[model samples]
Target chain A: MSDTTESKRLTTAQDYASLIDKFDTFLFDCDGVIWSGPKLIPGVREVIAWLRTKGKNVLFVSNNASKSRPMYKKTFDDFGIDTTDDELFNSGFASALYLAKILNFPKDKKVYVIGMKGLEEELDAVGVAHCGGSDPAEMEYMPAKDYTSVTPDPSVGAVLCGFDAFVNYKKYSKAHTYLTKNPGCHFILTNTDATFPSGGEFYPGSGAMSAPLVYSTKMTPTVIGKPNSHMMDAILASKDFDRSRTIMVGDNLETDILFGQNSGIETLLTMTGVTNEDHLLGPKKSSTVPTYIVNSLGDFKVLVDESK
Target chain B: MSDTTESKRLTTAQDYASLIDKFDTFLFDCDGVIWSGPKLIPGVREVIAWLRTKGKNVLFVSNNASKSRPMYKKTFDDFGIDTTDDELFNSGFASALYLAKILNFPKDKKVYVIGMKGLEEELDAVGVAHCGGSDPAEMEYMPAKDYTSVTPDPSVGAVLCGFDAFVNYKKYSKAHTYLTKNPGCHFILTNTDATFPSGGEFYPGSGAMSAPLVYSTKMTPTVIGKPNSHMMDAILASKDFDRSRTIMVGDNLETDILFGQNSGIETLLTMTGVTNEDHLLGPKKSSTVPTYIVNSLGDFKVLVDESK
Candidate 1:
């Protein structure tokens, strides 16, 4: 019914000025947009600081639940980027918020977690009860034939999953039992990233960690990360902002751009991360197109140049 | 294409007599048709012994790759069932055979394994050089932030995976590195069973174990187990049998019956384990129709009823 396919590119200082003038709120994705691995993208600090000077609400929306909010803030501090604690809303925090605020999880029931300590911290921060994650007992390997420990846990109301380095068959068996045997047990994931890029290659992500349960139980999980409206809601609850005056800026089309669209907002795509010029214009173009395009978020530095 | 869909049932002495006369060889599925867990199905011993007495070529085709040929023979010995070491063609053995004989894997290149000791034994039996599997170092867990240990290895020609209770981040990272970094690296699985039923419930199976790689790499591996023709070829390689004169006997229709159909052989469905009367004659009837059906493989013990 409407045209949202064409993405207008921002070039000159006038273009950047006009783009910034349209939105009072800006949501940014971290890994690819702000930095790559441990290396910070030049001018990222200048542009974000300029956004704060312009009285714009700058918040970081990250899908990585490998670290808690404080840890991410530490990363930002290490990068010398001026940002407050309330400016970050990661998938782990969103998932915890969904369970605590949106789902209104029964206080009596507990979550059977298949994730890292960061995810467990998020749940605790939200005042929700959880177990299994980072528990040495759950990490131990029972012989392949042993399933005696995989008993049905009636107390587990949800099986919350995220990235875990210790993902094993014991965790899968327990998750499978909870989903299959427990009545009305929810299956939730922080994000369904198939793999995460690190050490110049990809390793299995949170989605892959919980894949065994998905197969055995034939159940699809409610992903609480980018491209899902739940993450958007979590951000919205953090601060009141006009939806029309907000735009999501990131490097990934599948996650960032699609996420903005899912949240009923505009999106600005960048080429500094997983995407490139060919991705948007080549024969093998991605289906998830953004509302606007830019060479990189670093290009926003033009706004801070008084001479320009 | 004559229809091999409708299944005939054997009830009377004449029916059993005709059924035995029709097949010169019988391929039996161990877990469901012959036994359930540790308990052997009634009349299984009698039926197998009677088949041997009738000069029928008896062989076992199993998908459980957690055990090697010797281990499976030990299981048969524990149950007091009559079976030869060569009579069994498990998925692990099939996978090893596929790597060595079918694929003609280079002796200089080693396979990166993500499985248990049995799978390793099978690879060794086939004289295929391999690494990683059942290795204590691979079972150890590293910090979530550490990927320095996942450097690429050029010597790996393939990544062979099966069910492993000790599956952890190290094994996944290594497998991912070999598949992504190594050129022409093959991805092979012992079986793709989503879940294996045990302890009165289902647990993650071989397919579930490799799911992360499938999702991350966007590549499908060669599934060497049931419903795949590789298992059939492995069975054929072990013994001389006429496909037209042999029947595949099993309880489950999806794996066993489909495997038989893929092999261009007739299949006999049994109702002892996993499957029941309702499975064949219910509203949710399975699409994989067998050539013949029986209330139980034990009914074949009618041959032992001298009075009848």
Candidate 2:
């Protein structure tokens, strides 16, 4: 184990010659890698422009499925970084595509969704079905935050999980009971972020909602957000891209590091996200180490430019 | 699902004619089915005598791996039922055998066991190696509770989880960390009983110790006890048993019923155990339901006598 002071004092920026020589595509995690909360990190725009001028592809990836692709593009544009819907990847979008491919979706395959407006809008754009009404026997129902309108049915094909403010104990208990009674039913959680930064203090993330079900039913959810390969696969299958030339950049180890490791992509870990130096030193440090560590997105660009 | 009242009313003794006709060897669950806590349930002794008189094989089976075979045998003998060590099947006993067979254990395999004196005795009797120290750094360590100890070496050959009194947060965090670092290391849990009855209150069981690791590492433990076929195979493989004729009788649906269901042996459900009418009406009450629902163990005598 490395000494704490030594690791912290070690410059996050170093020679990127080898790393730049190895990759063409750049994937950036939104929350910490590019911006903290709604504010853009310093020198993030310049790095994107540099990458674009170097003819490298850039994708703005986020595991927060609460936001749509358009929302992501808007956020990047608002932050003075150039991006488009085509260059955005959200787990909710990927999840919709995944379910669509497997279930042979109908315009009427009423999906019981539990998420924010962005997720619902994405589902609507995909022409997938949705159900959330007063009827208790309905085949589909959407529960967001409170989900007072939604009642569980054994026939509900799948339960979708995402970010929402209306969630409460009743919703969780119902989901638990329903899934317990019917183990064959599918459970799709957007992501497993334990806590997400809000105003001042940290608020519980989708992990809080999914943890109980996972514990009780002993089921591993098929996550469809940032750092998971599900989103990567959806993007690659839709676009004519070379996976070998792709490089993934993120700030969290469990999700981002794991995503890159599982997807066979080069990963650059940025110190701008939820995982701090202490977190790294803790037992949670992944066995799959990052290929590069950077203090900021500016450092990422320096490596890219210098390597070429 | 059937109403609770109706399900309760439906609980009645059925002739074990069909079940006895199918299998000759009988396996009984000790807790609830035969005894509750320290007291033997009514008619338990007569039933065993009747089965023995009819020349049917009987084995005392339980998921509680906290105690050794001799302890259970002693308990039964004290309760007016004569039994041999060979007739007892506990997860702890099976776990030692499993480690001995698969791991190429040395004469002194030096294990870190996190269970009771029974588990330690079983390992000693098998001539395998073990240490039952509380310190994480004291060689190999097993977790008897959700939190017990953590090893700093980051490399232990195996982690055994069983029954322990002092479970806390620190131990779980360390064990989970060690597991993440050394993915190849083995995990052995005595049983997966979510909660067991103790002192008129439900307390977390072996499942609590095993589950957290299983969730974090995404690695399932090599279970050594009930519902798992390893012990059954170990017992039937012994000199006194015949594979072609064995009957497993118990009360719990998920563990006992499913054990018999998967093992291709006839099963009987007694009304005196952990499971009740609620389980019979829930998902587990389908075609996999027990072949017989006897009011008490004494009913077994009638079946055996009739067979004679």
Candidate 3:
């Protein structure tokens, strides 16, 4: 499904209806497309409900590793949108599921998490014991002069990285030690999103947090998020989905549209978030071209009303 | 001066004497060439003393930004080596000098330091008031949710980074805010050394600390250290020296030897620190070839004794 000149802009209600009819499954990126932050986009809730009424499979795929699936479901519930835990696939949950179910992580071995509580909860839900994340001892600043206190944990089989607020020298020191000292220790990251938008400003994301460990160890991690096939693999493994009938809808082209292109899925770009009009048509436009472009997910509400 | 077969290995006392006589100035990298961590390498003190006795200019040039010149002089004093503050050139000092002397930093504006006391002291020494580095407020972990507290100081004209022990999200966020919000806020770093050796282990260095800001702001800093001409410029500006008659001696080829090569001076590789013999002779040999190689600086003690 290429973005031909005629099909690129879905300005008409008939265009929206026809595009919706083409796909059986819709993968949504939550932060930008459906909502900006705490507030919901005007017509997004109605459009999602309308999609469910049409018996379409709607799944929320997010690179936010700070929140678990259930936590994300709570946010959906608070927003008056009914979303099940099974319908949500976040990077944190994907990382845990990949380690536990796919890699068949040893029960005796533990994972060293350089992330937040959400990643820890996901790992716990999968019965995978973890250390370092939210650990009070690790949160305190440990100087390099006292690095002797940062002893190795032999039981740690994997070092997983995400957006960590308590990222310090100690955490990096221990993670580096684990990757180098432990033979065949797995190095995993949720996503390499360089910057994350929040409170109307961009801040350093998970990729920035993981850079110290990357530099110290000189080892690249297996990234399991958007633009990487691992998240799609986890989603595909959990449910039966046809690639030809699936469409990825997102606001950012780098992670969202690129993820869809990399996964061989059709993509839709919504202009309500990080991306702008010139991002696709500008001189410095990205290679990840979306099949369809819409002003907002709210624009598709016109199609639902027309069908009614 | 290039690495000829005869001068590659200074095995004999006569070879050592000839090599010492070849240069009027000797720039030494402290870590791997002179000593490793708290322990001093054998014969290094004697050779340094012998070089001073020959009326040759001896300068201790290091990328270690964790300590100030006075603090570093204390280390030399502890090692029983008589050295003046003017004889030392470190990254922290270079960064401060680069901003104050070369860049002509605004006297009204302040610098935001994302490093330790050493870097802060250097900045203070130059009459440049700075915030963040070693500041108790910046040391604490500031969560992404409460980024509102990361208020930007409009008076901040620069964000200088080095090997910071207290690197956290707060520092990166504040630096990002300053770089993005302030019109002409400078982004400078002491060095981009990915990792530094300490106690037989490689730890995240200055580059790692600056990465988060680099990722968030998408800005490159003016790096002032080895392998860059800013540090050499500072050295040359402060003292009279003949570039043709000067030689750089270090254990690492990437930084120290590369520094010499980039600065158009002769370089000698010592095998006692971070690099090995195969590093130069193997398939992955660095492009920055050294003019000479020695087993250790201790071998030069033979030359000291021969002079006696």
Candidate 4:
């Protein structure tokens, strides 16, 4: 436990109810904060519904670039949570938004993608033209030492990297060639998460998938994910939200708590995901402490019971 | 061009002869110093054979790990240069030697390889049992989000990374899982060369291939290649060579010349490959200045002319 961070712990139903009442907007992170895997964390859906009933705005800000907004909606529906497409702001959408709005990417140029179909969908949503991602040609394993086909495409003005299950050397070589050979080519990364928890284990994340391109190209990507300020800037640009009245609730300290802190918003740490009490109280206390800590986001289900 | 570096330039045949006479042994980088693409650099063969006739030791020390020693020997034969298997010290062979001699890799445990057949052959020569390299299953495009097949194998004691045209997400997940789950698993890299010149263009190198695993696993590999001194250490342990009488000749300053400098030996830079005159005397002057400079190693053919 580090004395540097004085975090308030919510225990009773009054504390949970009081905490929710303070913010008009609540930002939730999906994986560990709402649902661990396939099942929804007990009481989370009830708490979210209760928050909505109180006219509180809720947004799901996730670093999971693997899923586009509509794909995430399906996951929400599968979990029996009523989440609309408009309330989600994932890294994939943020990346596309950054290219379309912030950079004002040329309409004629295309983005070389090193990601999944979800990322491509987001690019398409923003009317940003893209290539390579989830393309059957890019997924093919290039025969050893044959990179003649991996030449630079002049039409590619930017390289967008994210989570790609089909990440292969051909994609890396082509991305490297584009970033290196093409003048003024923007290197964009959805997020820099090292690993994503999947199927009861941590696998390579979107960041890991883009590491090779980063190494080979020797270019630093403009990360459009949490804690980078880009996502917050994008949200602020489009959505009308009072920053001071918003609270970010997530499981991971580095990604979630740090993101809120970077964006100048209040943050709540939930223990239902990647972090625990030891991370806040133990010898290796994380530097990024939250404004409030709770055993689980589901703890606020007591508010639902009170409503009944 | 920097005044901090007072390098001697060799021009005349007498100057080239004096430079070769000063060192009993020579370490040459293959790419630009010996050949460029499929064509052999003119006069390199004559210069090398002449150097051998004078009883001077010549070792081809290359960061190119795409080819094992035998494959390199075949290339040497194609170029009309008589280089024996023992005269080559590539990053691939250095990696195997490092594992067998320095680490004393356990015979029972296997190394999960993320490289090519050349890398596998080198590992085989050293008796390091390996899996995953060139495995057709590992190269297959794992249908999106299906990481169930990629599980932790306790038998994997080390993860050796090198250049693999077939490098895919399956290999990345497997390497990540092995390093994270397997206790005390060593991470090894053949070399950290960001790119390799092939077909007259630069492509992603061995280092880029392993970047994903390095990122996901959050592990620093023991790199057995140029500029790291691991290759020099391997050379010193296996061959009886005098450090004071050796000179490293290469085209690139970062990998080859810096490698020699790190090894406490003299370095000679040639102007036939990835570097040019501006690198030494331009606005973007490289910090790594070699001990000597030559227009090209083929310029040493002046010594051959003098002998004729």
Q: How accurate is candidate 1 locally (lDDT)?
A: 0.88
Candidate 1 error regions (>4 Å): A1-4, B1-4, B306-308
TM-score of each: 0.96, 0.51, 0.95, 0.94
Model 2 CA deviation exceeding 4 Å by range: A1-250, A253-296, A300-308, B1-22, B132-156, B168-184, B237-240, B281-287, B302-308
lDDT of 4 by residue, A164-249 (tens): 88887788888889999999999999999998876788888888888888888788889989878899887775678899999999
Q: How high is the lDDT of residue B206 in model 3?
A: 80
Candidate 3 runs further than 4 Å off: A1-7, B1-8
Kept native contacts, fraction for each prediction: 0.76, 0.01, 0.61, 0.89
Q: Candidate 3, B150: how far from true, in Å?
A: 1.8
Which candidate has the top score in TM-score?
1
lDDT of 1 by residue, B1-308 (tens): 44355789878878878888999989999887898888999988988888888798998999999999999999899989978888988999999988888889999999999998999999999899999988898888988668766888999999999988889888888898899889999999999999887777778889999988887777889999998988888666656779999999998888999999999999998888788877787988787889888878888787877534
- How accurate locally, in lDDT, is each candidate? 0.88, 0.65, 0.87, 0.88
Q: What is the TM-score of chain B alone in each candidate?
A: 0.95, 0.79, 0.93, 0.95
Q: Which residue runs of candidate 4 sit more than 4 Å off their true CA positions?
A: A1-5, A12-14, B1-5, B12-14, B282-284
Clashing pairs in 1: none
State model 2's lDDT.
0.65
In Å, residue A56's CA in model 4 sits off its true spot by 0.9
Q: Give me the TM-scores for chain A across all models, comma-separated.
A: 0.96, 0.79, 0.94, 0.95
The CAPRI category of model 3 is: medium
